[model samples]
Target: QQQVKQSPQSLIVQKGGISIINCAYENTAFDYFPWYQQFPGKGPALLIAIRPDVSEKKEGRFTISFNKSAKQFSLHIMDSQPGDSATYFCAASWNTGNQFYFGTGTSLTVIP
Candidate 1:
Protein backbone atom coordinates (compact mmCIF):
# COMPACT_ATOMS: atom_id res chain seq x y z
CA GLN A 1 0.00 0.00 0.00
CA GLN A 2 1.07 3.55 -0.61
CA GLN A 3 2.14 5.01 2.69
CA VAL A 4 2.20 8.55 1.34
CA LYS A 5 -0.72 10.24 -0.39
CA GLN A 6 -0.70 13.46 -2.43
CA SER A 7 -3.40 15.68 -3.72
CA PRO A 8 -4.45 17.98 -6.58
CA GLN A 9 -2.55 15.76 -9.04
CA SER A 10 -1.58 18.91 -10.94
CA LEU A 11 -1.27 22.68 -10.70
CA ILE A 12 -0.98 25.82 -12.78
CA VAL A 13 0.30 29.15 -11.60
CA GLN A 14 1.12 32.51 -13.12
CA LYS A 15 4.59 33.84 -13.09
CA GLY A 16 5.62 35.19 -9.70
CA GLY A 17 2.75 33.34 -8.07
CA ILE A 18 2.84 30.58 -5.56
CA SER A 19 2.46 26.87 -6.19
CA ILE A 20 1.37 24.50 -3.49
CA ILE A 21 1.27 20.73 -3.20
CA ASN A 22 0.02 18.67 -0.30
CA CYS A 23 0.82 15.19 0.96
CA ALA A 24 -0.21 12.97 3.83
CA TYR A 25 1.17 9.80 5.32
CA GLU A 26 -0.17 7.13 7.60
CA ASN A 27 3.08 5.72 8.89
CA THR A 28 4.35 7.17 12.12
CA ALA A 29 7.58 5.29 11.67
CA PHE A 30 8.49 7.45 8.70
CA ASP A 31 11.17 9.72 10.04
CA TYR A 32 12.36 11.35 6.86
CA PHE A 33 10.26 13.40 4.47
CA PRO A 34 11.63 14.66 1.20
CA TRP A 35 10.19 16.45 -1.75
CA TYR A 36 11.52 15.78 -5.20
CA GLN A 37 11.46 17.74 -8.44
CA GLN A 38 11.81 16.09 -11.83
CA PHE A 39 12.18 17.53 -15.26
CA PRO A 40 11.38 15.72 -18.45
CA GLY A 41 13.75 12.89 -19.33
CA LYS A 42 15.57 13.32 -16.04
CA GLY A 43 15.47 11.44 -12.77
CA PRO A 44 13.78 12.98 -9.78
CA ALA A 45 16.09 14.93 -7.54
CA LEU A 46 15.65 16.03 -3.97
CA LEU A 47 14.39 19.57 -3.65
CA ILE A 48 13.87 19.85 0.08
CA ALA A 49 13.57 17.61 3.10
CA ILE A 50 12.63 17.62 6.76
CA ARG A 51 12.65 15.40 9.80
CA PRO A 52 9.91 15.13 12.37
CA ASP A 53 12.02 17.28 14.62
CA VAL A 54 11.45 20.22 12.33
CA SER A 55 8.11 21.83 11.72
CA GLU A 56 9.25 23.53 8.56
CA LYS A 57 12.22 23.86 6.29
CA LYS A 58 13.09 26.24 3.48
CA GLU A 59 15.62 26.45 0.72
CA GLY A 60 15.46 29.60 -1.36
CA ARG A 61 11.94 29.85 -2.74
CA PHE A 62 10.93 26.34 -1.80
CA THR A 63 9.45 25.59 1.57
CA ILE A 64 8.31 22.38 3.22
CA SER A 65 5.75 22.52 6.00
CA PHE A 66 5.51 19.42 8.13
CA ASN A 67 2.86 18.57 10.68
CA LYS A 68 4.10 15.73 12.78
CA SER A 69 1.03 15.26 14.88
CA ALA A 70 -1.24 15.30 11.86
CA LYS A 71 1.04 13.11 9.79
CA GLN A 72 0.93 15.58 6.91
CA PHE A 73 3.25 17.78 4.94
CA SER A 74 3.20 20.24 2.09
CA LEU A 75 5.51 21.95 -0.38
CA HIS A 76 5.18 25.58 -1.30
CA ILE A 77 6.99 27.36 -4.09
CA MET A 78 7.07 31.06 -3.63
CA ASP A 79 7.42 33.53 -6.49
CA SER A 80 7.11 30.67 -8.91
CA GLN A 81 8.64 31.11 -12.30
CA PRO A 82 8.38 29.31 -15.61
CA GLY A 83 11.62 27.57 -14.85
CA ASP A 84 10.04 26.15 -11.73
CA SER A 85 7.62 24.11 -13.75
CA ALA A 86 8.16 20.42 -13.21
CA THR A 87 6.79 17.30 -11.61
CA TYR A 88 6.93 17.22 -7.83
CA PHE A 89 6.79 14.16 -5.64
CA CYS A 90 6.58 13.66 -1.88
CA ALA A 91 8.25 10.69 -0.28
CA ALA A 92 8.67 9.16 3.13
CA SER A 93 11.30 6.84 4.47
CA TRP A 94 12.69 5.51 7.69
CA ASN A 95 16.15 6.74 6.65
CA THR A 96 17.37 3.17 6.74
CA GLY A 97 17.42 0.14 4.54
CA ASN A 98 15.72 0.53 1.14
CA GLN A 99 12.14 0.95 2.19
CA PHE A 100 10.53 4.15 0.94
CA TYR A 101 7.08 5.33 -0.02
CA PHE A 102 6.28 7.97 -2.61
CA GLY A 103 3.25 10.00 -3.46
CA THR A 104 1.57 9.93 -6.86
CA GLY A 105 3.13 13.28 -7.87
CA THR A 106 1.92 16.70 -8.88
CA SER A 107 2.61 18.35 -12.21
CA LEU A 108 3.22 22.09 -12.00
CA THR A 109 3.09 24.60 -14.81
CA VAL A 110 4.02 28.21 -14.36
CA ILE A 111 2.58 30.31 -17.12
CA PRO A 112 4.58 33.19 -18.41
Candidate 2:
Protein backbone atom coordinates (compact mmCIF):
# COMPACT_ATOMS: atom_id res chain seq x y z
CA GLN A 1 0.00 0.00 0.00
CA GLN A 2 1.72 3.09 -1.29
CA GLN A 3 -0.96 5.41 -2.54
CA VAL A 4 -2.25 8.72 -1.25
CA LYS A 5 -5.50 10.17 -2.52
CA GLN A 6 -6.68 13.75 -2.13
CA SER A 7 -9.78 15.85 -2.88
CA PRO A 8 -11.55 17.96 -4.01
CA GLN A 9 -9.77 17.96 -7.37
CA SER A 10 -10.04 21.74 -7.20
CA LEU A 11 -11.32 24.44 -4.89
CA ILE A 12 -12.39 28.07 -4.96
CA VAL A 13 -12.50 29.89 -1.65
CA GLN A 14 -13.42 33.46 -0.94
CA LYS A 15 -10.70 35.69 0.37
CA GLY A 16 -10.36 35.55 4.15
CA GLY A 17 -12.26 32.31 4.19
CA ILE A 18 -10.80 29.00 5.16
CA SER A 19 -9.67 26.41 2.62
CA ILE A 20 -9.70 22.77 3.53
CA ILE A 21 -8.42 19.69 1.71
CA ASN A 22 -8.24 16.07 2.72
CA CYS A 23 -5.99 13.16 1.96
CA ALA A 24 -5.61 9.53 2.90
CA TYR A 25 -2.87 6.97 2.49
CA GLU A 26 -2.79 3.23 2.33
CA ASN A 27 0.67 2.59 3.65
CA THR A 28 1.16 2.38 7.38
CA ALA A 29 4.93 2.30 7.05
CA PHE A 30 5.10 5.89 5.95
CA ASP A 31 6.60 7.91 8.76
CA TYR A 32 6.95 11.33 7.19
CA PHE A 33 3.87 13.31 6.27
CA PRO A 34 4.50 16.46 4.24
CA TRP A 35 2.34 18.90 2.33
CA TYR A 36 3.74 20.82 -0.61
CA GLN A 37 2.57 24.04 -2.17
CA GLN A 38 3.41 24.80 -5.80
CA PHE A 39 2.78 27.84 -7.89
CA PRO A 40 2.59 27.78 -11.62
CA GLY A 41 5.97 26.80 -13.09
CA LYS A 42 7.53 26.31 -9.66
CA GLY A 43 8.47 23.19 -7.83
CA PRO A 44 6.52 22.22 -4.80
CA ALA A 45 7.83 23.63 -1.54
CA LEU A 46 7.34 22.05 1.81
CA LEU A 47 4.48 23.95 3.43
CA ILE A 48 4.26 22.04 6.70
CA ALA A 49 4.66 18.56 8.01
CA ILE A 50 4.02 16.17 10.89
CA ARG A 51 5.11 12.75 11.92
CA PRO A 52 2.90 9.89 12.97
CA ASP A 53 3.74 10.72 16.54
CA VAL A 54 2.05 14.09 16.36
CA SER A 55 -1.66 14.79 16.08
CA GLU A 56 -1.29 18.22 14.60
CA LYS A 57 1.21 20.81 13.42
CA LYS A 58 0.86 24.43 12.43
CA GLU A 59 2.95 27.12 10.84
CA GLY A 60 1.82 30.61 10.13
CA ARG A 61 -1.56 30.44 8.38
CA PHE A 62 -1.15 26.80 7.45
CA THR A 63 -1.95 23.81 9.59
CA ILE A 64 -1.85 20.06 9.28
CA SER A 65 -4.09 17.72 11.22
CA PHE A 66 -3.19 14.08 11.09
CA ASN A 67 -4.96 10.90 12.18
CA LYS A 68 -2.66 7.95 12.45
CA SER A 69 -5.33 5.32 12.99
CA ALA A 70 -7.35 6.41 9.96
CA LYS A 71 -4.28 6.89 7.80
CA GLN A 72 -5.62 10.28 6.93
CA PHE A 73 -4.59 13.92 7.13
CA SER A 74 -5.82 17.35 6.14
CA LEU A 75 -4.58 20.82 5.41
CA HIS A 76 -6.27 23.96 6.55
CA ILE A 77 -5.50 27.42 5.26
CA MET A 78 -6.69 30.15 7.53
CA ASP A 79 -7.52 33.61 6.21
CA SER A 80 -7.23 32.48 2.66
CA GLN A 81 -5.80 35.04 0.30
CA PRO A 82 -5.30 35.38 -3.42
CA GLY A 83 -1.57 34.93 -3.01
CA ASP A 84 -2.25 31.57 -1.42
CA SER A 85 -3.87 30.27 -4.57
CA ALA A 86 -1.86 27.40 -5.95
CA THR A 87 -1.64 23.66 -6.31
CA TYR A 88 -1.29 21.67 -3.14
CA PHE A 89 -0.13 18.13 -2.84
CA CYS A 90 -0.14 15.74 0.08
CA ALA A 91 2.79 13.40 0.25
CA ALA A 92 4.23 10.60 2.34
CA SER A 93 7.55 8.88 2.51
CA TRP A 94 9.39 6.38 4.61
CA ASN A 95 12.74 7.10 6.20
CA THR A 96 14.41 4.65 3.88
CA GLY A 97 12.72 5.52 0.62
CA ASN A 98 14.05 8.03 -1.85
CA GLN A 99 10.69 8.66 -3.44
CA PHE A 100 7.67 10.38 -1.99
CA TYR A 101 4.16 9.28 -2.86
CA PHE A 102 1.92 12.22 -3.75
CA GLY A 103 -1.77 12.77 -4.07
CA THR A 104 -3.28 13.62 -7.44
CA GLY A 105 -3.18 17.25 -6.34
CA THR A 106 -5.69 19.93 -5.48
CA SER A 107 -5.72 23.27 -7.24
CA LEU A 108 -6.87 26.02 -4.92
CA THR A 109 -8.01 29.48 -5.91
CA VAL A 110 -8.77 32.24 -3.46
CA ILE A 111 -10.99 34.91 -4.85
CA PRO A 112 -10.00 38.42 -4.03
List the candidates' TM-scores in order: 0.96, 0.95
In terms of lDDT, the best-performing candidate is 2
- Tens-place lDDT per residue, model 2, 14-106, is 999999999999989999989999999999999998899999999999999999999999999999999999999999999965589999999
lDDT (CA) per prediction: 0.94, 0.95
Residue 5 C-alpha lDDT in model 1:
96
Off-target runs (Cα >4 Å) in candidate 2 are none
Tell me which residue pairs clash in candidate 1. none
Highest TM-score model number: 1
**Which tens-of-lDDT digit does each residue in 1-112 have in candidate 1?**
8889998799999999989999999989899999999999999999999999999999999999999989999999999999999999999999677566899999999999
